[model samples]
Target: MAERELDPTVGALRGEDVEDRDWERVQPRRISDADWKRFEGYAAEILRAMGMPLDTPGTAKTPGRFLSALFDSTEGYEGDAKLVTAFPTECRGGPDCEISQVVEGPIPFYSLCEHHAFPFFGHAFIGYVAHEHIIGISKLTRLVRMFARRFTVQERMGSEITNALSRILQAHGVALYLEAVHLCTQMRGVRESEQTTRTTFWRGNYEATPALREEFLAIAGAHTNGHRS
Candidate 1:
């Protein structure tokens, strides 16, 4: 598979050369039905070893259900072909061109942490300044869910969304903010239930202009605080 290029500005924010990693290797591969059956059996055995009452009426199907849910939750690995499609911008160019930021926010998403396999869920806010093309509004939600369904860290997921949008739209700028409550953090280790993780990524013009970044953040932050309250 061909490697996708990460946006340089966003990559820099990550503090590493993102091109070093082969993203395709981390995506989900097709699993045969036989393989699934074998996996189910292994899961059952593991649950039994863990002292789970597999023979009980309620627990007998728990292994199968668990595997099914996991498969569904990580469906982002399948990839979305429609993500790259764009529409002609409404704004006409020249001196009369009125360029502005398009923002979509509070897009709910859920994902499993790669390390703990525990759920992290919350809202995403995306903003981009269009160039010659603009994407459909609903595509933003799909984009968020696509990345969110993968088994990954919060920071990486935000970067993926930011970079993908920047590449697809070739936008003048791209901005993304993610706020989530991670079960891995709340349900284990120190077990701080009140904790939540927030991540932001800015690229192109958004990075160059502090006003634009702050505007996006203000809109996203207002909606987030209001939604939670």
Candidate 2:
């Protein structure tokens, strides 16, 4: 049987923030049964073509599951960053309050390694200095999910998360660190006994001042040597 770690599935996408745009408008209107059958058959063929053993019990459902997982992983295209921006957290001074604040996150995330489409899973630690606004803590994780659920390489994911904070929070500074393991590499290919991948993006004040940057890195357990804990 195919084994999965069974991490928490994001519960039904609730909250008024979720948009109801009809995705069907952009997708194919129809696929005939014959066509569907051919397409479905292509699933197994794809793995077989990739040199994956289909006869293995662990892979029996992989063809069907892969198709489902592929679509689900790339669903970020449907999200609007503006949705969260619309209701920017109100400050006592009404989003004009500036404060140097750190939002540390041990937030869990999941994504597909672009090179393999196998799972990459782990946590992100984010810290930012808010300017005129304090975002809901939940939104920080949402931001991480927003950026992760898109087509991106690991380096891009790290930078995009920090970039989003700078743009939305109008932050004075932001620091984001991503530590995730790509199962495609670890379990399928040349397995390394240590070290997965670590990517970080420090922007604005985080980049301009060494002390400020070090403070954030210290919190993330990152070393000046470009290594992470």
Candidate 3:
């Protein structure tokens, strides 16, 4: 198991802002039986090599559980990021049609550490300004989860999420912040536990304009350090 915590401040949107909003949960596709069988066999072999007695009642289901978790962490498991059906929403852009809207909150995520295959889990903060379109708050959260539930580096994950949103929504700007505690670092190497690794990605106005970036950080309550777009 991995230590994953979302800061209470992640979803700091005002009550009225989220109320009346239809937040639909994404349904996960089922993993195939063939894949499950293969993974179970492999996991059992690894456990046997690790000196685990698989015949024991308590241990019998460990391999299946481990395999299930590994696949579930990726959400789609054998597929790509789930397709998001976004609806048309009114944007309150000014005369120039430059609208600044931000959806900030904590979204739970977990991933495998490429270095050691241990799990790293934490929260991600996302906010964006709109040009012609504004995404629903629920979609933003789903997008973050879709990207986070895959095997990738935190830096790349942040970047990928930003790019995906920008392309899908064609927004004027986008910003993302990820903070996670890696089990690989906690249980091995230097064994540091208290510190967290942070990664950020920004694009369009949030990248070219310092004020916009700062405002986003202020809203998301993110520390502006080690930013990568």
User: Who wins the lDDT comparison?
Assistant: 1
| Per-residue error (Å), model 2, residue 197 | 1.5
Residue 195 Cα positional deviation in candidate 2, in Å, after optimal superposition:
1.6
List residue ranges in candidate 2 displaced over 4 A.
1-37, 48-62, 80-83, 86-99, 222-229
Candidate with more favorable, higher TM-score: 1 or 3: 1
- Give the local distance difference test score of model 3: 0.67
**CA lDDT, candidate 3, residue 99:** 35
Clashes of each: 0, 2, 3
- Can you write out model 1's per-residue Cα lDDT over 12-39, one digit (the tens) per residue? 3333535422332345568899998999
Q: Tens-digit lDDT track for model 2 on 1-229?
A: 1111111112123353133222212333344768656666899898899898888999977887876677678765556433344133444443234335575767778887778777787788887776544566687777777667756678877866765565556556788878888887778657767456878788877777777667776876743233332
Residue 126 in model 2: lDDT: 85
Quote the lDDT for 104 in model 2.
70
Q: Model 3, range 1-229, lDDT digits (tens) per residue?
A: 1111111112223464242111223455676899889889999999999999999989999999988788778762333333444444555566334436575667767887666778888878887776545667676767776666776778867776776666555566888878888887777657645678878788877778787777776766643232322
Which numbered prediction scores highest in TM-score against the true structure? 1
Candidate 1, residue 156: Cα displacement in angstroms equals 1.0
